[model samples]
Target chain A: MRFIHTSDWHLGRTLHNQSLLDEQAQMLETLLALIETHEVDALVIAGDIFDRSVPPAAAVSLLDAFLDKVIQQLKVSVIAIGGNHDGQERLAFGARQMARAGLYIQGPVSASISPVRVDGKHGAAFFYPIPYAEPALVRHLLEDESIQSHQDAMAALLSKVQAHNSNGLPKIVVSHCFLDGGSESDSERPLSIGGADKITPALFTPFDYAALGHLHGPQYKGAEHVRYSGSPLKYSFSEQHQNKSVTLVDMVPAKAPDIRLLPIKPQRDVRIIEGHLDTLLAQGAKDPGRDDYLMVRLLDTHAILEPMAKLRAVYPNVLHLERTGLMQERSMEGPGRERMQKSELTMFEDFFNQVQGESLSGPQKALMSDLIASLHREAGQ
Target chain B: MRFIHTSDWHLGRTLHNQSLLDEQAQMLETLLALIETHEVDALVIAGDIFDRSVPPAAAVSLLDAFLDKVIQQLKVSVIAIGGNHDGQERLAFGARQMARAGLYIQGPVSASISPVRVDGKHGAAFFYPIPYAEPALVRHLLEDESIQSHQDAMAALLSKVQAHNSNGLPKIVVSHCFLDGGSESDSERPLSIGGADKITPALFTPFDYAALGHLHGPQYKGAEHVRYSGSPLKYSFSEQHQNKSVTLVDMVPAKAPDIRLLPIKPQRDVRIIEGHLDTLLAQGAKDPGRDDYLMVRLLDTHAILEPMAKLRAVYPNVLHLERTGLMQERSMEGPGRERMQKSELTMFEDFFNQVQGESLSGPQKALMSDLIASLHREAGQ
Candidate 1:
C-alpha cells in the first residue's frame, strides 16, 4: 500500500506570539497538492494532530476541514493517532463512527490493538496504530505491572498487537513516542517528569514499517524501517536547520518497503541569519525570502542602539534578535566563569576574540602579555 | 417514528463544585434502558451536550462510550445539535464521517439545514437540525443583514429548512434556542449577554414537531408540538423543585406529534431542607435519600459553629449551608432601608415572625406596638 506518513502538525501553535493558523492553513494546501500529485492511497498522521489537549476552536475547524477534504474529497483513507499533546478521548470523539468512512482515528492505549487494513495494487497491508501512551496508563490498561518504562510499555503493546495480527501480511505500526537515538527539538514537550521515556526501535522488528512522531527531526532510529516523519513546520528555533518532509511508504509482501521522503515547503521557513546590523538590513531588502520567520544575530563589536527596531524596517518577520558580543560577555559571567578552567591570559584572549569576532594579532597579544606581567610585578611590590 | 428526545445533558457539569460524572454515567444507563424498552427509532439530543466548550477528558471518554453503546451496540441512530455553550466546530468534530454511521451531529448555523430522516412503521419523517445560531452568525451565513434578532434568525433558518423539505412528510425541527413563553431555570445559560434571545414559537408553524432545548424546564412553548425535554438532572438549587425528564415524540404522517415526558430519576437529587442543625441531623438518619445533594437552612436563632462540618457527619453531600436569621437581618439593613415601604413597627413585627417562625399572637402584637410607641416618643424627646 502507498501511504503518506506525517505527524505533529501542532495546529494552533504560535511562533513568537504570532499565530501559525494562517501558515498552517496554507501548508495544508501544499499537503493537498502533494497528495494529489503522488496519488497517495492513504494518509497516516501518527500523532500530535493538535498542539494542545483542548485546542482553539479555529484549530478544531481547520482539522475538520482537512479531514473532510482528504477522506471525502480525495476518497482516501486516513489513520490518525493521538499524541501526548492531545487529550486522547477528545481526539477520539466519533472515531469509531469515522472509521466506517475510511478515517481510522486511534486514541489512547488499549490492550486489544486493532489493525486498519489498507489494500493497494500489490496486496493488503495491516496497519496497527499504537497511540502515545504513558507507562502508568499502559500498565493499568494492559494489567502489566512490570511495564515500568516506555520501553516496557511499547514492548507489551506491540506483543498484544502481534497476538491479534498473526496473519502473514505486511504489518505497519504507526505510533508516537520518543525513540532512542532520535533527535529532539525544544517544541516536543517531554512525556514524563522523570527520565526513561525513550523506547528502543528494536521493539518494531516484527513490523515492516514504523511511522513515528514526537521528535521534530525526521530520521531513522536504529533501523531504516523505523523512522520519524518529523513535524510539518519548524515549531522551535532549535529545529531551524532541519528540512521537514513527509515520508511516503510503499509496502509489499515480499521485499523491504520502498521509502521516500517528499520534502515539504513550509508556508514561511524558519531561518537564522548573522551579519553586521547595517549589512543584514541591506541583505533583507534584497532578499526574496525576507518574509520568512527569522532569528538575526549581529556580529558587530560595538553596541547598536535599537538594533531590533532598525532590523524590523526591512526584515518584517524577525522573531528574535541578539548582539553576540553582549550575549557572550553575559554568558561568560555565568557558569562560564568556573567552566573556563584557563589562565587569566588565556581567558582574556578568548574574551577579546569573542568581542572582536577575531583573534588578536601576535604583536598585540605580546604587548598585552607584557602589560599583564608589569601589573603583576606592581601588585607584588 | 418514535424518538427519545433529550437535551441539556451538560455532561461534566459539577453541582456545587462536586463532580457529577458518575451521576451522568448512571443517567446514560437509564437513557439506554428507555431506548431499548421503547424501541426508539432514533435518539435525538437537541443541544448543550457538554457543560463547557472544553470538557474534561474523562467526560469526553464518557460521551464516546455512550455514543458507542447507542450507535454501535444497540444499532440506534442518533441526531444531536450544538448549543450556545458548545464550541460548535469542536463539538461537531468528525460529524461528517459520523453521519454515515447514523450519528448525525449538527453543529453551527448553516444556510442549508439538511434533514436527517428517521423511518418508523408509519413512514419516513424528515428532521431539520437547526443548531443554535447567534443573530450575527445567522445574518452572515444566510447573507441576510436584516436578521437582527433571535426571532429573525430563527425565522430565516426555519424558512431555509422549509424550502428544503417541501415533501408532504411529517417534519420535525430539532434545535437549541430560547423560545418565547418557555419556562426557564437558573441552570439554563442565557444565550446572549444582552436580552432578545427568545425566538417566537410561531416560527415553527411549518414543522410538524419541534424538539427544543435551552430551557431546563420540560414544557411546551405556545404550542403542544413544540417542547423542551429539560435536563436529565437538576443542575441548580432553583431547579430543585422541578421534575427532570426526557421527552418522547411519536410522529406519523398527517397528525400532531404525540409527546410524552419520561421522568428521569437522578443519581442524587438536589434538595433544600430547612430545620435546626440538630433536628436535621436526627431526621437524616431516617431519610433514605440522605445522600442527595442538599442546601441546608438553619432555622435556629442561636449561633452554630461549623454547621457545615456538623452537617457533613450525617448529610455527607450538604452543598450549601445558611442561617436564615443572620441572613434575613443582613438583607434588611441594606437597600431594605429605602425599599422597605413598611412602617418600622410593622417591620419589627415581620422580623419577629420570621425569626421565631411563627405569627405574633394578639397579646404579643399589642406589647410590640406599645414598646415601639415608647421608643418613638423617647427618640422624639
Candidate 2:
C-alpha cells in the first residue's frame, strides 16, 4: 500500500497583520499536484489544517477546494483529524455523511475499535484516525479516567484500538499530536510546561505506521514506523533552513516500510542571510535573490533606516528584517518594569511602591493597592 | 417529507453572564423528542450553533453529546450551515467526511448547488443548503460581479440555484440569514436598518419551501413557503415573550409547506415583567414562579437599591434589571455630553470656548486635541 502523509497546514495564519491565505492556497495546490503525480493510495492530513479554532473564510474556501479536488474529484480516500488548533465540535459537525464519499474524518477524541478498512496489495489495511485530545477531555471520555496528560491520553486511545484488533490486517494510525523527542518550532502551542511526561515515545507503540502532526519538523522519534510529514510551506523565520517535504510510505507485510521524501516547492523560497547592515546593503547592491523570500538577520550595532524598503527593491520577498546582534546583547539584560508589570496595575503598583518607598503613605498605599488588585482580578477573570 | 427546521443553538450564550447552556441543552432534548415523535425525515440546522466563534470546551462537549444522540443514536439526517456568528471554515472543516453519515454542511458564500436527495414515501426531495453570504464575499464568488448589497447577493444566489434545477425534486432551501419584514431584537446583529431592503422575499422564488434562520422569531414573511424557523431558545430579554419552537416542516407535492410549531420546554423559562420597584417587589413576593427565568424591566423613577439581589431571591434567573423608563427619558432628552464630545476634557474645551469665549494657544490646543483624540480612540477601539 502506497500513501502520502502530510499535516499541520495551519491555514489562515498571518505574519503580523499580513494574510498568508494566498501562499497557503498555493502550497495546498502543490500538495495536490504531488498526490496526482505519485498515484498515492490514501492522503492523510493528520491535523491542524487551520491556524485557529475560528478560521477566516479564505481558509475555509481553500480547504473546501482542496477536499473537493483531492477527495471528490480524484477519487482518493482522504482521512483528516482535528488538531489542537481545531474546534472538535465544529470540525466533527458533518463528518458522518462525509464518510460515504471516501473522505474519512475523525474529529472526536474517542478511539474506535474497527478502523476504516482499505484493500491494498498487502491484502487489507485498517486506518485509524485519532484527533488531538486534551487530557481533561480524554479523561472524561475514557472509562478508566486515569489519563493525566497528552501521553496518557494517547496511551489510553491506543489501548482501545489495540483491544479490538482481532483480524491481523496491517494497521496504520494517523494522529495529530506532539510526539516525545520531536523538535518543535515556537509556533506549536506547549501542551504542558513541566511535563517530560508529554514527549514520551511510548504513545505510538501500538500501530505499524504512526503518521503524526503538530510538530512542524519532519522527523521520527525512537520508532522508525513513526514519522512527522512536516508542513508544506515555511511558516516562520526559524524554519528558514527546513527542507519542507511530504513522506510517501509503501507498506508490505512482515517487512520494513519504504519511505520517500518528496520535496515541496514553496510559493517563495525562504532563506535567512546573516550580515552587518553595511554588508547586507552591499549584498543587496550587488545582487539579491529576487524570487526567494529573505529574512535578513543583521549583525548591526543599531537599527537601520528604511531597511525593508531598500532590501525589498532588490528582493521582492524580503518579509522580515531583524537585528540579531542587538537581540543577543539584550537577552542577558535584567527584566524591565514594563515586562514585569504587563498591564497588571496591582503588580505595577507594588513595584512602584517598592521603588519609591518613602513617597507613599500607609492608608493611601493600602487603598491604591486594594483598588488595583480588585481591578486586576476583574479584568483577568 | 417531514423535517425539523431549527437553528442558532448558541450553546455557549449567556444572558448577561448567566449560563443558558443547561436550559438550551434541555430545550434541544425537547427538540430531539419532537423529531422522534414527528418521525422527521431530516433535521435542518441553518446556522449559529455556538454563541461565539470560539465556543468553550464545555459548549463543544455539549454539542458533541447532542450530535451523538441526534445523528449516531437517533439516526437523523442532519443538514446545517454556518451563520454570521459561526466561523464557517472551522464549522465546515471535516464536513466533507461527515456528509457520508447523512450530515450535509454548506458553508461557502458562493452559490454552491448542494442538494441532499432524501427518498420518502411520496418521492425524493432535494434539500438545497445555502448558508448566509456576506455582500463582499458574494460579490467575489458570484459570476456577475455587480451584486452590491445583501439583497442583490441573495438574488444572484437564487438565480444560480434556479439555473441548476436538474433533479426536479421537491426542493426546500435552508439558509441562515436575515429576510424582509423581520424584526430584530437587541441580541441580533443588525443586517440592515430597513425592513424590505434587508432581504427581499423574491430570493426564494424558485424553492418550494424556504427554511430560514437568524431572526429569533417564528413567522411567515407574507409568503407561505418563506419562513424563519427561529432560534430554539430565548437569547435575550427582548425575546422573553417569544414561544421558542422548532418548525416541523412537512412538505407535500402541489401544496404549501405544512409548518407546525412544536414548542420546546425551556430548562429555565425567560419572562420579562415591567412595573415600578415597589410593585415589582410586591409581584415577586406574591407570585410563586421561582423556577422560571426573569428579566425585570423596572420602570422606576429612580434607581432601585440592591435590585439584582432583591430580584434574585424570588426569580433565581433575574439575569437583567434595567430601568427602561430612565433609558427612554435619557434618550428623549437628546445626546448628553458623554455622547457628544465623549470625554470630560473635550466637553470642558467645547464649553469654555462656547460659553466664556476662552481660547487656547495654538500649541496647547494642538497638544490637547491630540491627547483627547488618542484617549477617545483608545477607549473606543
Candidate 3:
C-alpha cells in the first residue's frame, strides 16, 4: 500500500493581513493532482488544517473544495488529525461518520487507540491516527496525576498503544507532534523545549512508520520510519527556497520502504528578491511567474512610496515587502513618545533608584520635584 | 426515505450565562435513538449547530461526539448546512470529504443545487442543503451588483436548484432560515424585520420537503413543505412549556407524509414556580424533580436573604430567579430646597418651564447659580 503524507495546511494564514487564499488554493490543487498522478491510496494530513481556530470563511471554502476533490472526486482515503492551531472539536466533528467512507479524522488526544487498517498484498497495515497531545492532557488521561513533561506524555501514549496491539501488523502512526532531531523552521510552532511534552526519539520505538505533521519541514528522527511530510506550500520566505512536496511511501515486503518526494507546483511562486525598489519591480514585471506570491526585500537607500501598490501592478500577489537598509534611518526617528508620559519614566526611575539604594544630586532632586509637581497638577485637572 | 429533521442545536448556547450544553446533549442523544428506532435513513441538521461563530472548545467536542454516534454507530446519513448564527465557511470546512461518508454539508448558497441522493427501496430522494445566505453575498455571487434582500437571494437559490434538477428526483431542501408566517420565539436571532434579509415563505415553492432551522419552534409557513423543525432542547424559559422534539417524517408514495413528533427527555427539566420566598423554598425542596433546572419567581414582600443559596440547595440547576414584587417607600426627610438642587426632578421642571416660556422663581435662580458655581469650582480644582 502506498500513501501521500502531508500536514499543517494552515489554510487561512495571512502574512500581516495579506490574503493567502489564492496561493493556498493553487498549492492544495497541485497536491491533489500529485495524488491522482501518484495513485496514492491514502492522504495523511497530520494537523493544523487551518491557520486559526476560527478560520476565515474563504479559507474554509477553499479547504472544503480541496477535501471534496481529494476524497469524492479522486476516491482516496484521507487520514487527518487536529493540530494545536486547530480547534479540536471542530475538526473532530463528523469524524466518526466520515471514517466509514475512508476519510478518517482523529481530533482530540485520547487514551483509546484508533487504528485504520488498510489491506495490502502481504496482509494489512494498521495506521494509528494520533492528534497533537499536550502533556497535561496526557497526565489527565493516564490518571497518574504526577506526569508533567512531554517525555512522560509520550511514554504514556506509546505504552497505551503497545498494550492495545492485539495483532502485530505493520503499523503506521500519523501524528501532529514536535520530535527530537528534526530541523526547526520559522513557520513550525514550538510546543515545548524542556517540559513534560518534549518527547525524544526513544518514545516512538513501537511504530513501523511514523507519518508526523506540525513541523513544516520534511525530515525524519531516530529511524527511517519516522518522517514529517512537511507543508504542501512554502509558508515563509525562509521556506521560499525549500522544495515543498508530499511524501509518497510504498510499503511492501523484501524492500526497505520506497519513499519519494512529490513536488507541489505553486499557483504562484514565492520569490524573495533583494534589490532597490525600482529594480525589484522591474524584475517582477518582466518575470513570467509574477502572477505568483512574492516577498521583496528593499535594499533601497531611502523608503519607497507605495511599494506594494507599485509591485502589485505586475505581481498582484505581492504579499510581503520589507525594507532592509532603510531600517537604520527609520530607527533614528524612533517610536512615537506620546504613548509614554514623563511621569511614567519618573516612576520607573524612582523605583530603580530605591532598588539600587541611590541618592539623588541637588539638580536631579529639583528636576524630579518639578516632574512630580506637574504630574500632581495634571491629576487634579 | 424516512428521516428525523432537527436544527438549531446551539450545543454550547448560553441564556444570560446559563449553560444549556448538558440539556442539549441529552436531547440530541434522544433524537438519535429515535432515528434508530424509527429506522430513519438520513438525519437532517438544518443549521446553527453552534450559537457563536467561534464556538468554545466544549461545544465543538459535543457536536463531534454526536456526529460520531450518528454517522458511525447508527449508519445514518446527515445533511447539515450553516445558519445565520454559524460562520458558513468554518462549518463547511472538510464537508466535501465528509460527504463521501454520506455526511452532506452545504454552506455556500451558490452551491445549493449540489444534492446528496439517498436511494431507498421506495425511490431516490435528493437532499439539497441551502445554508443561510446573506444578501451582500448573494449580490457578489450572482454578479447582479444591485440585488438585495434574502427573499431575492433565496429566489436566486431556488432557480439554481430548479435548473440543476435534470434527474427530477424527489427533492428535500434543508435550509437554515426564517420565513413569513413563521412564529418566532425570543431565542431566534432576527436577521431583519422587513429589511434586506427578511425572507418570505413564497420563495420555497419547489421542494417536496423543507426541513428548516432557526425560529426555535415547529411552524408551517403557508406551504406544508416549508416547516421549521425547531430546537431539540428548551433554550430559554420562554420555551420551557414547549414540547421539544425531533420531527420524524415517513416519505411514502401515494400517501401524504406522516409526521410524528418524537419527544426528547430533557437533561434537566425546567419548572417555573411562583410563591413567597419561604413557601417557594419549602415547595421547591419537596418537589420530586428538584434535580431539574428551575426558574423560581419569589413573590416576597421584601428582598429575601440569600434566596439563590436557599433554592440552590434543592435545585442545583436553579438558573433563573426573580423578585416578583417589591416596592420602596419614598424618603421625605431632606430639606426641600437642598433636595431639589440635587434632583433630576428639578432639572425636568426647568426644562418644562423653559418649554412653557415660564420665568424661574428668584429662589430657583439663586439655587441654579449656586449649583453652577459649585460645578465650576470642582472642575477648576
For all candidates in order, the CA lDDT equals: 0.85, 0.75, 0.75
User: Model 3: residues >4 Å from true position, as ranges?
Assistant: A119-124, A143-148, A159-169, A193-197, A202-208, A265-381, B115-128, B135-148, B152-173, B195-209, B221-226, B289-298, B301-315, B318-324, B327-381
Candidate 1: chain B TM-score equals 0.86
All candidates: DockQ:
0.64, 0.27, 0.47
Query: What would the per-residue lDDT of candidate 2 be over residues B1-381, giving only the tens digit for each residue?
Result: 788888888878888788887887788778878877877878889888877767776787677677767777778788888787876665676566667676677766554667778765435687878887778778887656788788887777777667766466777888877776787767777655554338777778558888888888887775877888788888887787788888888887677777789888676777788887777777777676766777788875433447688777677777677779657645655375444443445445655665567765688677876777787778784
Q: Compared to the true structure, candidate 2 yields what TM-score? A: 0.76
TM-score of 3: 0.76
Q: Write the per-residue lDDT of candidate 2 for residues A81-131, one digit (tens) a residue.
A: 888887666666555556677777777766354378776433567788888
lDDT of 3 by residue, A93-135 (tens): 7677667667787878887778788763335677888888788
Per-residue lDDT for B1-381 in model 3, tens only? 888898988877886577888777777778777877888888898999889888887888788777767777888888888888887677766776677677787766773368788875446688878888888888888887557777777788777777766375667888887777677777888887654555787777556788899988776786766778888877777887788878888776655567888877786776677877777667766778888777877765433447799888867778888766532111342655444344434454446564666756788777776876587567663
| Per-prediction share of native contacts kept | 0.85, 0.54, 0.83
- Give the candidates in order of lDDT, highest first: 1, 3, 2
lDDT of 3: 0.75
> Per-residue alpha-carbon lDDT of model 1 for B1-381, expressed as tens digits?
888899999999998899999999999999999998888888999999999889888988999999989999878889999987777889999899999999999988777888888765545778889898889988998888898999998888887777874467777899999987778798888888666998888888667888998988888877888888899888999998899889888885567887888989988999899987778999999999899999999886545556798898999999998788656654656464333323455566657765787777899888877776676677663
**Candidate 1: deviation at residue A200, Å?**
1.8
Model 1 has a DockQ score of 0.64
Error of 3 at A364 (Å): 32
lDDT leader: 1
Model 1 steric clash pairs = none
